[model samples]
Target chain A: MGGLTVNTKLLRQILVGFVRDEVYKVGVRKGVLGLSGGIDSALVAYIAAEALGPENVHAYCMPYRTSNPESEAHARLVAESLGIKFKVIEITPMIDAYFTLTPDADNMRRGNKMARERMTILYDHSAAVGGLVLGTSNKTELLLGYGTLHGDMASALNPIGDIYKSQVWALSEAMGVPSEVIEKKPSADLWAGQTDEQELGFTYREADELLYRMVDQRMSREELVAAGFDAAFIDNVARKVQGSHFKRRLPIIAKVSNRTIDRDFRYARDWGK
Target chain B: MDFTVALAQIKPKLGCLDDNMALAEAAIEKGIAAGADLVVFPELALTGYFLKDLVPEVALRLDSPQMEKLKKLSERISIAIGFVEVSADYRFFNSAVYLEAGEIRHVHRKVYLPTYGLFDEQRYMARGERFRAFDTRFGRIGMLICEDMWHLSAPYILAMDGAMTLICLSSSPGRGVTESEGLGSAAAWQKLTTTTAMFLNCRVFYCNRVGYEDGINFWGGSEAISPSGEMTDRGAILEEDFVLAKVDGGALRRERIFSPMMRDENLAITVKELKRIDREKDC
Candidate 1:
């Protein structure tokens, strides 16, 4: 089966062009991206470097106490290999300080804080360096509602988002990312020993295959199951995709006018060129 | 020169900037395979339209490093796409970026901010103040957002600025309307497109988004019109696909010669003055 092969070279060029064009047009030169040490961030860093050059790409590793040390090392390794500037800021003390102040914070709330903390750091650096935060999440993560809003999901521009986990591996390999980074078990490193498959209860290969069939192909449950996917797995994935749909869209505004932005306010980017 | 353009009708996940760019790349590849010299995508194609609060967070500055990828993609074919452009002062506007020959040729921000109904654009997007046409290899082309087509001044400004072709990118919702409504709506939309083509004595290209996101379904009715006020080519509505059409730039000159609409100063002057008065009133 010839699945949609994301052209990594093309993808990198496109990302680089996106950043460089925006920078050249608007006159901003630097950029920042959260370095999670996962395949997503690894790929994003490489693309940003290609787009803005290593001198311009700033990779920040915001690790909490709960975050695995291995992931931090991996993030550093990727940043160093690419010759991009890197920084490691531990979020444990800050997260602890916030929790100390708001003791009622639950896991979900704390997770959100962690995500937001990373964003604050990225944006602050962005201001100081005149850069935009590049996003690192993938389509699978976005569809699964796997990321915290305004946290890991935040970015001024994302280059690898369309690539599924499986496809990210393909592109990472093409971009010469180390096998260790590409082949490692996927995790957000949000907590110690927190593998993405373990927490989500599905492997990237399985999830991406299912998602490719469902989203890219728009196959129904019966069709997917008939193709030999487990019925429960299909339902679970579908439910996740459905549940997290809101995160994938703009806030619905009630239409009450002659020309709505998403409706009638249509114009080409180079309409008057 | 005859310009063959493709309007890519795609479904983009909001906030999924990378994926949206990938989709755009795929669309361009398709367009190139079909021999298109330029490809146009829906407004905010990179970041996805309808990003409410996320617009500020995800909005890209016009000169952000993210657009380098698109610029490289333009090495072979010209591309135009829309995104949330944040300025130096942190004000955000809905803007389009034009890429050709490995460079960003121009950036046009949407001027009209629709606040009512399903649009809180005014809440998040700052209105654009400038309107002008740019010179391209194809010809002098004009750009506008979806709602900009409704205003008489947008096309007028482009024409006054000496545009020979007008292109509009849109993400118009279907709004639970029926087929009959769509037919009527299409007629109305076609009238607007044709009117602009006729008024400017220039060809027009309009592309719309197609797909259901939340409750708002984007009805894709991408089309291309000749200067003679004829729908030369149109894309499918409410579907994910692209429309390819060959437009003869020479046809504009020929059509203008045949129709003499460009020389009709009586009504054109009044319309231009009325638009100027309205713009002055707003100021």
Candidate 2:
């Protein structure tokens, strides 16, 4: 309803149905996700809670010591409001333990480590709840490859992966997601003072509009430029989308067999059961 | 000549042929119970959509046991269902078959296999080359599978062949949204179906599948549109529904008299113009 205007209520029903059907296909009626207190994960929680029922939705607020306390508070607010299962898992200990061994690790490496650490915990806990780990990556981040793969990107199911961030914000508000979660500055909270816009170098508002043109509308570079996008802006967005292609796909299988995996012997993820 | 059609808007588990076959049998029983003369299922209703590399694995030859079972059921009431058709040459096609009176009536291979934007039909299935109209108890009927209806000429060719009703089977993914509508795909489909019905002066029974195949949700909303371009009956959105459309044949007859677009059609001139354009483009 923001960059891409849609009937948020209808979109919500569709996404809820997506979660409900996808989870049930695997013979589970439960969903698990990291609640980062950001809109993306909060929105997924709201959808999942509605789909599998709040009793079946398990939420973990995994925060590092340096991670914003406000994120944890907002995550609590969302879980309480939805009446879902909520737990606060401190990621600081594990992340700190890893950084202790590597001690001179850069902020980028540290951030990636925290993400992977959370992924390991989330997956391990997912087994406990017997629920699928729901992904929180929106289309904007997924296209730009902004999240760490096999980390925050590892999910058994992702309802928000197709909707853009601006759309996430809009949908979150429509779905009665706590304004405390929706109105906050978008962040991964991998490190202190980290906001998504600061790291991405562009606001989702600008990126979503540009992406709506470049990706969804399928506008060419010249057409995008003609439609009021600067060369620099287009180049940055396009490069990030192209560069992060690996994050969006399965690991490449080498073609050696007569019928190779992913190359010729491709079956849908929904193949059979 | 009023007739009842049960729009079998059922969610199929992808590539689960036996499961879907069972589901189909139950739906057929439901339709028969509802006193429906015909039961229509969405495209790829037998094996489900998004088969991809599993296309060959699930494809049913016309004489396969699966078709034999469906043909047997047709003895009670008519059935129109979508499946991957395996030809004798081993070529596979996204096909729909009409079974009536325990006989295989018509098999319509999808002409336009959409390969862009979440669809990969062309990568797996062979393209159908023709649009033909065949006789049924209901009268002359034309069947088009999904993308075939997107091409304006496909319906035109069938109309020219004297089909009174156009049965369009689709497994359309729910996508795009506007303030005015829930799904842009559904809105686009309405526009296409109604216009084709209006201009072609025929009824359109658009049967679309429901449920998720991967993340792409097929919005159900299976509907029956009159020749006057009105949605006489529509099913539920994003949910399975057994929508019963009481199609009054008088609507088509009355609409034909009023607009007469079909009556005024000149195929000779249209074909001549197309040939001229083709020859010029060839040169």
Candidate 3:
């Protein structure tokens, strides 16, 4: 979108390098990334495989009754293509049992339940296997408040949190993901006929381009509109980025002392005697 | 002569060359009004620190036209400022240039290149190997960069090399922590200043930068610590201002004579020998 500013291949290499170094530093032998049949998760699985090795990467596919069958099949195909260990678990029973115990559970409640359930399964499997849970949400989703908080957004470390969705597609192509996964209508597939563009009211290309110009380039709204983007589109994307700033930061805690955690407690991540 | 030192905890605009020079001029006027004999600014006060690759472009040659303007300003009051100094060979140094009576008296390049997180000084600056004390009318002053104060050897070496007072310029970032947190950068600053003063048994004038550049925010908490490790004056955190304090050369002499840490050659040898012993044990 708008002539990809960041090189996807280089971004992938950097992320893979960071992941590999972090794993080695922490002394973790394996890593698990959720394969959600979405391009982001699929790309993450591939990158994690490249970083930690196919044998060390475990791809978990959690499907509910509402989940499309083709989505599950595609996820399995991605895992197989990467030669990674794939596990399929049905979440319908878990959702049904929980809903039955608590009637009148709305869409918001159910959506949150599904997200937490998936994370619980991922973390449990990660703990059992002694691997870190890799995050799949990209920068676009993170910036626009598109991710389920503490659900898909939760991970031991995120490799693709800085890459936008358009960049994710470019990386997917470089990753040798199936063209279907790349070219297919982008979706979370939470419901039938659901697409991310249709829900967000803007295409990933537009959103990614606008977000890149806003965040990375730090361009003004007038500059963006002058650059040939619609004024309304610029306003909408700016609002989304501003509105979702909380998702990107740590919760601010009040300081009653001479030094605070975020301020004083900074040593280098690798700082040691 | 009665000496008053002003530590200018000023924020420098990153990459805005003209605006930064203007700010430096205004800060000098403020120091002169305060009747300060010497005004000390933070490290990289002229162009700003934490610049990724723009150091070479923004760095000034020692005898550049910009230094002439600073030299003119120095005629009013003795000025100590930090900036990137480009050598004839084109090597860049994080140097502290001291100007008095319209001439640069001494230029000290930083030796400690912090190559750790959020810092890539090693990539940009060549380390200075020699440590020397500057003879000033006020006292025998020594200059050091931010991380140089962290090592016990730096202040001790400066003192043994004939420095009666140590002046350290720092651009220490406000590592994402609140003022109340005991583990933050402010606490680290206090510990470093106190420990260095105690070890050297000399007064220390520490000047730190303020404001955010890139992802790191510099917390300006300049302070003057006496030889007894007491803070005589402390500047406000995250604000730009100057702190003026009178240095009692007699009190400093008394503290050193009472403690005798500076004159204890046997103690210094024992410490060095212990370190060598520890290294041999590890081997």
- How well does each candidate superpose onto the true structure, as a TM-score? 0.51, 0.96, 0.53
lDDT (Cα, tens digit) per residue for candidate 2, span A16-60: 998999999988889989998888888999999999999999999
Q: Candidate 3: deviation at residue B186, Å?
A: 0.6
A1-273 per-residue lDDT for model 1 (tens digits): 346455454445445555565454345787798888888889888878887889998899999988888888999999999999999998889899879988987777888899999999999999988887888888889989899877888876666676687777877898888789998898776667768899999897889888988987889888998999999999898899899888776577788998786665554231211
Show the lowest summed lDDT stretch of 10 residues, model 2 chain B: B175-184
Evaluate residue A56 in candidate 1 and report its C-alpha lDDT on the 0 to 100 scale: 93
Best by DockQ: 2
Model 2: runs farther than 4 Å from truth?
A: A1-3
Model 1, residue A235: displacement in angstroms?
Answer: 1.3
Candidate 3 regions off by >4 Å? A1-273, B176-183, B266-283
Docking verdict class for candidate 1: incorrect
Q: Is candidate 1 or candidate 2 better by DockQ?
A: 2
Candidate 3: lDDT of A184? 86
Give model 2's docking category.
medium
Enumerate residue pairs that collide in model 2.
none
